[model samples]
Target: MRSGNPRDTDLWEWCCGFYPGSHPGECSGGTAATFDQARADFEAAWRLFLANRTEADFQAWRDHKAWTAEKYRRFDRGERMPHDWRPGQ
Candidate 1:
């Protein structure tokens, strides 16, 4: 059996935003063996990351609102109130 060559493997790193004056705000995963392959990988990774992050943020917001609602319900039911609480003051 023959061993595979390391140079035959396509390894790339993501690179972006290195201009002197203008910030292009553009990014690319650099130097793939083929442009199509690189673009496919980058776009897929970007979309997956975006979706996951957005979902996490939304879930956190929903949990916080639920906790606040529960606290307000307790106050309305006269279960407990803060020491600074006063009626319509």
Candidate 2:
């Protein structure tokens, strides 16, 4: 559940976004495209992430609550900050 979709800001956010016995949300295409698009973003972002990749930096982002929230808000507003940035990650 990492397609970098707005509906899912992070692992916990994504878990909360779902309801029991319900289907996943959508990024587009009005289907499970929620996961599909996130996967696509992750794969593409992964490649770009290879250069100067830093587990620590990513960890820093993971632990940044305010920054993450800002990120999520950006996406929620249909704004693109950066692809590597996963909302509230």
- For all predicted structures, in order, the TM-scores are 0.30, 0.24
For residues 1-89, could you state the per-residue lDDT of candidate 1 as single tens digits? 11353767565444432222222443334546665767677777556544444454545556656556766988789887465644332
Model 2 residue runs over 4 Å out of place are 1-33, 54-89
Superposing all C-alpha atoms, what RMSD in Å does each candidate have to the true structure?
A: 16.2, 15.6
Q: What lDDT tens digits, residue by residue, belong to model 2 across residues 1-89? A: 34566873543212211122123341112223456555665555445444444565556545565566777888899997775754455
The TM-score leader among the candidates is 1
Please estimate how well model 1 matches the true structure, expressed as its whole-model Cα lDDT: 0.52
Q: Score each candidate by Cα lDDT.
A: 0.52, 0.47
- In candidate 1, list every pair of residues with a backbone clash: none
Model 2, residue 25: what's the lDDT?
A: 43
